[model samples]
Target chain A: MNETALKELLYKIADDQLILGHRNSEWTGFGPLLEEDIAFSSMAQDKVGQSHALYQMLQTLGEKDPDTVAFMRNADQFHNCILVELPNGEYDFSLIRHFLYDTAEAIRFEMLSESSYQPLADISKKIRAELRYHTLHANTWVKQLGSATEESISRLQRSLDSAMPYALGMFEESPFEKDLISSKIFGGEQALKERWIKKIEAVISQTQLRLPDWKALQPVTGGRTGKHSEYLQPLLDEMSEVFKIDPTAEW
Target chain B: MPTREQVYTWLEEVKDPEIPVLSLVDLGVITDVQIINNEVLIEMTPTFVGCPALDFMKQEIHETLNRHGIDRVTIDVTFRKAWNSDLITEKGKAALKKFGLAPPPSRELFTELDVLEHATCPRCNGTNTELRNTFGPTLCRSIHYCNTCREAFEQFKPL
Candidate 1:
């Protein structure tokens, strides 16, 4: 088996969860409604905790501990897709991003549940169950707001349009994608992207929102190789603020 | 030497930090207890992956067992197996109901939309209830309103 390919896949997944989880948590006090706040926070906790689990698995496979790996890494060291690192622009944008990103995550975890690696398969099985609720939340809201008011519909449509390129970036294939696929470690980025498009379209069809022709759009890639937006470095710096305070001290 | 049964009994005094009415054992957080050599090892599973009250629960367990003369305790939080709502004991359900939060439905009956559609009201014992919101103030609950009593309450979500 190609160990480097598997590690690359794991790093990207873990980084995506961690970054998006931090973004979700930022809505704790800022959500438009109380229930929305709680919902985002709930998902935030789940994603971050899930990221920790993946990092722990990485540690077992010979890496630094989860905290160090998560908190101490520079933006260029991260392997997350660019979609997760963008600023949560507004409730509309954030919601749209959440819907887009989590749909991909749910499908990704589902595919991973059947992986040849027992540990990855086991963790994926457990995580896939949690992602069900996340997708349910995202789908329900997107469907509701997408069809609710002209204003709501228009706002969501705008957000959707702005997020599409980044959403496509989520499917950026690694150099070792073929190795991972042939080794049965993962179903590969192309397969996951196809599934994600179908799932998201199914939800969008129920709403007034439009699913753009993916082929016409240029995907905002580079995240899988550690190149990131200007926003990622500041976010990483903030995330590690406390941990970096005393790297040697246990809190 | 405290027998395994005695340790279980001692654990009964350890309440879930978030839900004070229910003990950790009844909440299904405590999975296994073993006495090996001079140490007592207890396995646990969290209701949610990032359950904020875990540290407090662990501390409570340590204090509860230590008070009972078992100081050599090791708490292992395991995620190898997923936790299900079915693990909640019968007594735990009753406690949740009495504490003004509806207990979760059986795991077998938790179809996709069933959680929002059906929740017997804790206050009026009424089947006529509406889910106010799927998200609640806490991690494992959802807000609901009883049509009969016109009272809003929380229901522990079926995991």
Candidate 2:
């Protein structure tokens, strides 16, 4: 594969992990319960780790260090989805966001597990191992909140209603969709969509929450092609604050 | 230069910060210890990502190797495979038992339940236990309670 095509692919994967990790980190001390706080923290760290591995892989392709790649990108230059970047509105909102992202991530990772790219394939395998926990955690919460006290059920219903509209926009494709599809870097988007639909449908039915009868949210365009949400700018500002102050300083 | 046996022996002395009776190596978090000519390269993985003991583990690994004069030390942390109860060595299990924590029982269903499930008390060996909570003092475990003992205990989580 050409160098540019390769970088595009690596950056897209890295960017998604990086941004989603940021959103999840916000739950560290704030999750509704202690177990969830720790559990959510684990997912956030795994996402960061995925970014770290992808960044290290990108380093082999010859541009920047993982930290630089993660912290230095411009707001419009990020490739993560809007679903991942939007703020966590409530416990239910966070669960919905996680439900969408992780379901997609698990499917994406399963496909990437067989990627033609050996290094990517290796990382994908490792990432998938951790994805199991992420799946269990998210699914458990959705089930509990859906079946819990009326306060919890109502809150969850409202959160789901509010968040589902933005959650569908996470599937925006990149420039190398065809090459990735043909090369088997991962499975086709159709396969990903199909699995995601089946898994979420089962979870939604179990929760007694209806998948809104409305049409799925339209793709906002450009995230996979390196354009991102306005929410990204402030998030990046906080995330990169230290790095920008002194690039040579180590934590 | 120390031989591979010596490296292993030295690593054995490095106890897990959280579970003192158990060494990080015994947990299989440190998968391999090699002495290549003069330097030591330690292949390690965290039981969980963002493990609070990780910094201390790395530091101890580095310090232990250097103190014994193994030249240099490099620890490669991998998270490719999430750690589970199976990784805890027999010695690690023994240590947990000594510390009055329930070691994994042989039952397959025992493996299925995490801290979220009931674990018999190590002190009283009672099965009438329920999950008290999941946040323990460290990231590697969670707090559980036993009605028999009426005391809270830490359960080594299958992260």
Candidate 3:
């Protein structure tokens, strides 16, 4: 197994969870409804915790400690897809992003459950089970609001269309795609994207919203290689502010 | 030299911080206990990977064993035996119901939403319950509303 490839894989997955988890936390007080507020907050806790577990796995492979790896990294050092790092625009936009992003993650972890790396497989199984509720929550809302009324439907439709390009960016191939696939560490991004498309389409078909033509949407790539949008650096700075102020601070 | 059974007995003093009535042993997060050359090694798994109660539970385990006068204690939290609701004991299930939270149904036949969507209300033992939210106040719970009691309750979600 290529150690570098494995670390790259772990970093991207962990970074995605951490960044999205932070974005989810931003919804704690701002959800359209109280239930949605609690839902996003709970999911935020779950995502951040899951990322910490992944970072621990990385530490065993000779990476830095979870706290340093999470809090000390700059935007260019992260490997999360742009979809997760983007600002949570509105309730509709956030809902659409949640629906799209978690759909892929649910499938990604499911595939990783069978990973040849025994430890990854073990944690993946646990994470996969927890993600079921996330996808369920996302699908329920997408279906309801996607079909509800003129304003609700249009709001979601517009967000879905705007988010589609970045959502497709989620499958931006890793430089080690071949090694990860050949070594069976991951089933590969293409396969994950295919499964993701089917799952999201199944949910979207039940609603009034339209999924843009897959072939026509150009993916907003480069995040996997540490090239991120202007949005990421600010998020990183804000997230690490307290930690940077006092690196040795304890709760 | 303490027996493995004795160590488990001492562990019974450690309860889940969230659910005071339940012991870690009955909750089934305590996966294995071994006595190795006067040292005690315990392996445990979390109910949910993100469960906030995990660190507190780990601390409680160490404190409880230390109080038992076993100075050499090693507690390893792993996903090796990944916990599922099925790992919980019948005693634990009863304790949860008694604590006013519905116990998760067996996951053996848990493929559909129906199992998760409907829970037997702990208050009235009524099956007429609607799932209010899948994500609850805690990672391990789900919110449900029972028509019989006309009150909302939480369930120890089946994972």
User: Each prediction's TM-score against the native?
Assistant: 0.94, 0.86, 0.98
- Taking chain A of model 2 alone, its TM-score versus the true chain A equals 0.92
lDDT of 1 at A8: 89
lDDT of 3 by residue, B1-159 (tens): 799999999998899998999999999999999999899999999998878888899889889888889889888989989999998899989999999999998877667667877799999998898988888888888899999889999999888
| TM-score of each model's chain B | 0.96, 0.85, 0.97
lDDT of each: 0.89, 0.74, 0.92
Residue-level error in angstroms, candidate 3, position A27: 0.6
lDDT of 2 by residue, A1-251 (tens): 54566677778777878888888888999978877777677677778877877888889888788888788878887877777788877777888788878888888888888888777776676677567667776887788878888888888788777766666656665666787777777666667877887888888889767677545545455667656667889999999998999998978
Best by TM-score: 3
In terms of lDDT, the best-performing candidate is 3
Computed on C-alpha atoms, the DockQ of candidate 1 is 0.50
Q: Give the residue spans of candidate 2 off by over 4 A.
A: A1-7, A149-151, A213-217, B49-56, B78-84, B100-116, B132-138
DockQ of each: 0.50, 0.29, 0.83
Mark the regions of model 3 whose C-alpha exceeds 4 Å error after superposition.
Answer: none
Task: Write out fnat for all predictions, comma-separated.
Answer: 0.38, 0.18, 0.76
Candidate with more favorable, higher DockQ: 1 or 3: 3
Query: What are the runs in model 1 whose C-alpha is more than 4 Å off?
Result: none
> What RMSD does each model have against the real structure?
2.0, 3.2, 1.0
